[model samples]
Every structure is written in structure tokens, then in C-alpha cells.
Target: MEAVRATEIMVAAGARELRDGQTVVVGLGLPQVACVLARRTHAPALSLLLEIGVTNMNPVDTPIGLADSRIFYRATCWSGFLDILGMNLHRGVVDVGFLGALEIDRFGNINTTLLKEDSGKLRYFNGSAGGNDVASLAGRVIVIMRHEKRKLPTAVAHLTSPGFPGGRSRKDLGLRGEGPQRIITDKAVLGFDRGTHQATLLSLHPGVELQDVIENTGFRMETPKTVPATPLPTPEELRLLREEIDPKNVYLG
Candidate 1:
């Protein structure tokens, strides 16, 4: 247990959100690792689709990127982006849009592109390679990112992907994908309120304080009556993570 790391916990938390037979469109970073963890654990039938045209990915090692050969290795199907992003994604067959973010707001809006002059120093990101499309088309979305004040801003300076925006709902915008359902971070798991769409505090990780989540968030979130400790990763989950999934510390590192 002592060797278990925060990144492991984060991956485990994100993985648990996936059900046994859900279809997921995974992004490049921790999201992809979490998807793999899900398939190897409880969701053995989980369909992992990368927008880069790989389907049913069971990577022996965490891929460096969506285009990495390891992600395509032993995959069930190797189609082009049109079949994946254009067809499966656009057709609304994706069950989950597992994504990472540079910054996310209380409304779950994510910014993976440039912060721009609004955030001080102007910076350019790779833009939303498939982020906007995934968020717009998946049946539901889940975000995985580190817990930090800067990363969890009151509002993202640049909105690369849509969420439950401050004023309008995803439906009002005519977006097909259900907006963010859960945000998994190192410190806590935050869920969106059904009515308000605000990122509500749900559970804190073991040894993480309420104040830790609060202070790390850019905007204050409403505390529920009970914020339980996140269920620690099971022994088997930890074992698989360390020994099978990321033994070399690729993504877990």
C-alpha cells in the first residue's frame, strides 16, 4: 500500500466510472491509461476507441500518444480517422469521452488550447485535436486532470471543449454529447449538480482534506452533507496497475 501513488489512485478512480460494457473514446494522456485500467479490471468488455483510428485497444504499455504504434498494436480494428472520429463519434455511439484538460471551470468547461492574454502569458496549445468533437458527440463525458488552483479555474480563458456552460445548457447549444458527469483529480472526485450544473464536491481522496480540495479549486464549490473518503484502490487494482499496466512508470509516473 505504501508504494501506491496518487497517479494510481487517480487512474483507479477514473476507471471505476466506466461500466462493464461501455464504449469509450479515450484521449492521449491519463484518460487513455484509465481506460486501459478499466478494461483490464471490471470492464473487460469495454470498447476503447482512439480518435486516431484504433479500436478496442489493449495496449501492453501506456502509449506515448494517440498515434503511437503501441496503441494500435493488437487492436481489433485499424480504420482511419473518418471511421472513428467522423463516423462512430459523430454518430453518437461513444459512451464516454474520457478527456484531460489544461484548465476546467466550475461549469466543467475545459480549456486545452492557449490560455491567451486573459491568463497573462500567451501560449499556444496543439488545439483540440479531437477534444471538441469528443465532448460534443459522446453520450457522456468524464474529465481527468490534476488538482490545482490554476488548473481548476473559476473559468477557462479559452474554451476548447463545451461543458455545462455558465449560461446555456448543452442541449440549448444543440450539442449531442451529455456534458461532464465526473471530474477525477488527485485530491477529489467532483460531480456536476443535476440542476445547477455546478461542479459539486462529492468525495475526497484518503488523507485529502476538504480544505485541500477547496483551496486547490479556483472557484468555491458547494459541499454536500457527506463527503466520504474515496474508496482506496483494491489490492487487485493496485497489483494490476503496478505489475501489469504501467510497470515501467510510463503514464503512472
Candidate 2:
């Protein structure tokens, strides 16, 4: 069930966007799964700009990381780590960015920094790489995370990377383009209300009810009278997702 949820979220995240020839900046974890699935299933020609600087890589198997050999073997160019942020991302060339967050607020601020403040205990989880640049530069940002009260918060404790940054801060900073367009999770799909930047329930998964989604969220959500169930994965999509993208089932675990 957890594997199904992870695959569903990855496929939903991949299905959101990526025109046939657009370039996307992909992060690790679920973002990697979605990017590969996008290339294989929907946008075959989509160019993937990996965090470690592999541009336009099409891999038979999902690479473990940016340094994976498949990246260099399939890339148009392999750039240095610094070049990805200082040059490519800063240039606004990436059409989309797929990211994972520990906690995401209603305004779309993401926190991957730390689970707890004084925890040298959680050091393994406290890394923020390319998230700031991806959120800032990508034309569109898609966040994939587990839907739980702990992960979906009214406000993030720390803003490792700002997406909406709240209306006031965004307006004051004169930021352009809508940030963090959508968040795809295990139980439902959510989007930021255009007027308030507050999270709005867009739809729910099959067998998932409104109460199930609402119970997981930390705040009151404005839901439509009718929320549709997400479409089930096609046979081919499911097979490809399980075999090629996540053979080891890392995401499922």
C-alpha cells in the first residue's frame, strides 16, 4: 500500500506538466522517479537537468544520484555542481522543478532542514542542496510529499526554501511567477488558492474520502463540494513504475 502510494504520488507529480521538449530540473527521491517516468511514459523527449549537472539524461534505470554513471553516459553535457546553480538554474532555463519536502506550509514554504531544532540526532535528514535555487528559478515547482499532520503544517518551522513566502513578502519582494504551483501527496492533490496562497484540496485518491484528507491536514481546508478520485494507473504505467523506476522499492519503504 505504501509502495502504491509512493508510485501514485510520483506518477501524479510527473503527469502534472513537462511539455514534449521542455527542460526540467529534478531532485532526488520521488522527484527522480517522477522525472524518469515522465521521460518514459509521457514526455519522451523531455530534457532532465539533474542536480549534479547532468543535462538531458535518459536512463534505462533511475540513477542513484547525480554522480551515477548513467547520467554522464546519457547527458548532453555534464556540468560542475556550482555551474548548475550559478549558471543554468539562475538563467531561468528550467521549465519545471520536481522537489520533495519534509514539511510544507499553506503558503508553499518548504522545510527539509531539520526535523527538530537541537537534534544532532536528525543530522542525516538535515541537508538542503539546490532546493533554494530550484524554487527560486524554475518556471513551475511541484512538491511531492507524504500527507500527514506532521508533514503538512499551518506554517513551516523553518523556511529552507521559499515558494510563495506569503502574499505580503512576495508582494514586498516583487517576485514574479506563481510559486509552487501544486503539491501531490499520498492521499490527495492540493494547490495554492490564487487569492490567499492557502492550500486548497483539489482532489482525492481512490477509496480516499474528504474526511481522510482533512484529518491529516493541520488547518481548515476549503474543499469543493465534489472531489474526484485520482485516475488509476494504466497497466503499462504501473509495470514501468515498478520495474524501471523503483525496482528496489526504495520509495515504498
Candidate 3:
């Protein structure tokens, strides 16, 4: 069996947030791994809606990206981005969405566009490929990313996807569903404050300290007086994550 790793632990943590029978709109990378693990273990009835137009695919292998051929294997329906993003997402049918951002602010607004500049020109990372739609329209959104001061900024240099912008309701922005609900990181799981929508420390990862979370965060966050440790991955969950879901540790790394 593969040794439990930080990335694997993060994936397992993210998977626990999903419920069976929910329609999950998934992005590439760690989000994909988490959704796949959930489907195989706890959320078997979970329907995965991909950004690149595949839905409910019983995928066999870990896909590197949304366009990977493996995503279409045993897929239930075949469509284009227009039908998936415009039809289903626009209709607000995606119950949960898994996303990542280069930088995320305390309010959950994401920035994936540009991190730095080279040669006096802006250096762009992957642009918003349904991130805006997913964050805006998914019934709930979960962001998975490495926990670090640089990645968790007080404010993103630019906002690529809106998340309770200025603590306004989704309806106020003409969006259909609730905005970001959770952020799963390497060291902690952060949830939004119910009233203010600011990031709040929900739980610390095993062996991680509240001070670690605060020191790593670039901006001020709501810290609980006593943060319970996040539940560790069970033996069975770790087994399936290593053997069935990602034997090669493609995304577990």
C-alpha cells in the first residue's frame, strides 16, 4: 500500500465533503481526483459533470486534464461545452463544484489569470475555463489548493472568479446559487463565515497547529478559539485512494 501523503490526505479530505446523488461539476487536477475517489468510495451515485462536455463517466484511470481521453470512457452523455456550461450550468443544476486558484482572497474570490510578469508583460496562468461559471452557479463550491502564504493572499491581484464579492449575495450578482462554501488545503480546512462570508478556520489538518495556519495565511482570517483536528483518512479510504483511484499517485503527488 502507498504511504499516506499530504496530497492524498488532502484528496481524501475533499472527498468527504461530497454527498451521494449530487451532481458535481469538476475541474481538472486535484478536484478530479477527489470527485473520482468520492464516487468510488462513499458517493457512488454522485454524477460528475465535466467542463469539457462529459457527464457521469465511470472513469477508470486518473485523467491529467479535462480533455484527456480517459474522461470519456464509459461516459453517460456526450455534449459540448455549450450544452454543459450553457445549458446545465446556466440552469443551475450543478450541486457541487471543485475548483483551484493560483491565489484566493479571504472572501474566496479567485485569481488564476496572472501571477507575475516577465519582460514587462503580464505572465498568465491558465485563464478561467468555467471557473467563473462554476463558482457563480454551483449550488456550493469547494476550492482545493496547497496551503501557503503566497497562495492564500489577503486579496488576489486580479479576480478571475467571483466569490461573495464584497460579501454580497449571489442573487445580488444575478448568479443562481450559493458561492464558495469550503476551502480544503494542505494544512487546514477553511469555511466561510455565515454572515460575513470571510474565510474562517473550521479545522486543522492532523498534526497541524492553529498557529501554523495563521502564519501561512497572507491575510487575516477568522480563527476559532479551539480548532478541532480534521478527520484523518480512514484505512479503507486510504486503501481505495491508493489502489483503485490513483495507483500511480498522478494527482496524489
Please, what's the RMSD in Å of model 1? 1.4
Sort the predicted structures by lDDT, highest score first. Answer: 1, 3, 2
Model 3 root-mean-square deviation: 1.6
Evaluation by lDDT, superior candidate among 2 and 3: 3
Per-model CA lDDT versus the true structure: 0.87, 0.75, 0.87
What are the runs in model 1 whose C-alpha is more than 4 Å off? 117-119
Model 1 — TM-score against the truth? 0.96
How far does residue 99 in candidate 2 sit from its true spot (Å)?
0.4
Using all chains and alpha carbons, the TM-scores for the candidates as numbered come to: 0.96, 0.88, 0.95
lDDT of 3 at 189: 94
Residue 90 deviation, candidate 1, in Å? 0.7
Candidate 3 per-residue lDDT, tens place, 123-210, comes to: 7898898998898888999999999998998888789999988877777878777889899999999999878889999998888878
After superposition on all CA atoms, what RMSD does each candidate show versus the true structure? 1.4, 2.9, 1.6
How many collisions between residues are there in candidate 1?
0
After superposition, candidate 3 runs with Cα above 4 Å error: 1-3, 117-121
Question: How well is each residue in 4-95 modelled by candidate 1, as lDDT tens digits?
Answer: 67898899999999998888998978888888888888999999988888999767766789878988889999997799888898987888
